[model samples]
Target: MLICQLSDLHIRPAGQRYQGVADSNRMLGDAVRHVQALDVRPDLVVLTGDLVDHGHPDEYAYARELLAALTIPYLVMPGNHDDRDRLRAAFADHAYLPATGPLHYCIDTYPVRLVALDSTVPGQHHGALDAAGLSWLKATLAQDTVKPTIVMLHHPPFVSGIPYMDAYRFLDAAPLAEVVGAFRNIEAVLCGHVHRPMFRRWAGTVVCACPSTTTEIALRLAPDAKPASFMGPPACMLHRWDPAEGLVSHISYIGDFEGPYDFY
Candidate 1:
C-alpha cells in the first residue's frame, strides 16, 4: 500500500494568496498534479491539516474544487487554522467524518489501518488531545493489534528544536505519547503543522512530519529567533508499505527539477 501525505496546504479563496504573498492555492494545485503523475500511484492520500488559510466557506469551497482533481481516495482532518464545523460541512459527503464533536475516525479498508486523530483546539493556534480523544484513540488501537497501523494528527506530539514552531507544539503530548507507546503495532505517527519535513523517534515508533505545499517555516533554533517563513521548494511525503519491508517513506518535492541523468 502506498500512502501520500500532503500537509499545511493553507488554501485561500480563488485568486487570493496566502498571507498576501505565497500562492498557496497554486502550490496545492501543483502538488495534486505531481501526486497524480507519480510513477507508482498511491492507494490513498491523507491531508493532515490547515487545508485552508482562514477556514472560510469560500476557502473550503475553493479547496474542494482544487482537491477534486485527485483521482485517488483521500482523507482530511482539521488544523488550528481550520474551523471544524465549516470543514465538516464542506466535506459532508465523506461519511467517515462524524456529524459533531472531534473529527476522529479509523479506516480499515486497506492493508494498513489508519487511525486519524483530531488534535486541533478550536480558536487556538496550538493543539491538544482531550481526555475523550485519548480514550477514543486507546480504544481504537486496541481493536486490532496485528494490523500495521499509522496514526495521523495535525500537530506533532514532540517538541521541535525550532523555538518559534515549538511554541505551537502539541500541548497534551505526554498522555498522548503514553497511549501511543503502549501500542507496538503502530508503524508511525504522521503529522503536518510544522511546514517543514521532520522526523523523530517517539512513543516506540517514528513520527514523520510532512512539509507544507506552501511556505517552509524558517528553521531557527535560537531561543530568541524571530518567527519567519520562506517560499521554498514545496514537497509531500510518500509512504510505501510492503508486507516484508514494513513502511518506508520518501519525500517527493514539487515543481520541475533537473534530474533523470544516468550515472555510469
Candidate 2:
C-alpha cells in the first residue's frame, strides 16, 4: 500500500506571519493541494509532528482547517510545540489519535498495521518514552500479526548528526529500542521532528525522518547551527511498501529553488 508521509506543517495562527516570512499555513495549504493532485490516492496520510507553529488554540484552529482539506483518513500526534489537549479537542473524531489516554494507538487494515506514538514530553523541546508509553508499545508489539507493521513518532530515535537538531532528539529511547528491536515483524521506524529527511538504522531497525512541508531545517553539516532564513523549497516524503517490495522512500521537493528542471 502507498502511505504518503507529511511532516512539520508548522501551521501558524491565521494572519500571523512567522518573522516576516511567507505564510507557513499557506505553504501547508500548498502541500495539501499537491497531495490531492496525486494520481493514485494514498491509502493513508501519516502526519508525523509539529502540526502547529505554537501550542495555541488559535494555531490549532488554523491547523484544523488546513488538515481537513485532505480527503484521506489521516493520523496525527504532538511535537514540542504542540499541545496534546488542544490537538485532541480539535480532531476529536480522528481514530488513531484517540480522544484520551497514551496519545498513541494502532491501526490494522488487512495488509498493514500502523502505530502512531506520542514522543512529545509535556512542556519540553526534546523527547522521551515514559514507563506507561513503553509498556503499551511492548504489549502492542507482542500481538501476533503477519501484516507488515510500521511505528510512527515525532522524534527520530537515531541522531541526525546535525548537532543542534540532535540535542533535541528522543532522550530515553532505549526502552523504546528494546520494544522495537525485539519485534521481528516491524518494517521501519517512521518519524519527523528534525525537519530534514533522513534514513538510518537504530537498534536493529530503520529510522526515517520526513522533511517539512513548510520551511526546512537548513542543511547543517556544521556545528552550533540553526535553520536558515526560512525561505527554502518545502518538501515531504512518500513511502511505498509491499510484502514483495518491502519499503522504499522518496523525497519530494516543492517550490522554486535553484534547479535545472531539464533533460540530459
Candidate with maximal lDDT: 1
How many backbone clashes can be found in candidate 1? Answer: 0
Best by TM-score: 1
Model 2: lDDT to the true structure:
0.82
Give Cα-based local distance difference scores for all models. 0.95, 0.82
lDDT per residue for candidate 1 within 121-195, as digits (tens), equals 888999999899999999999999999999999998888989988889897699999999999999999999999
Please, what are the lDDT tens digits per residue for candidate 2 over residues 107-194? 8874678888999888889989888888888888788555688999999987777888888999778788988888788888999988
Candidate 1 global lDDT = 0.95
The runs of at least 3 residues in candidate 1 whose Cα sits more than 4 Å from the true structure, single-residue gaps closed, are none
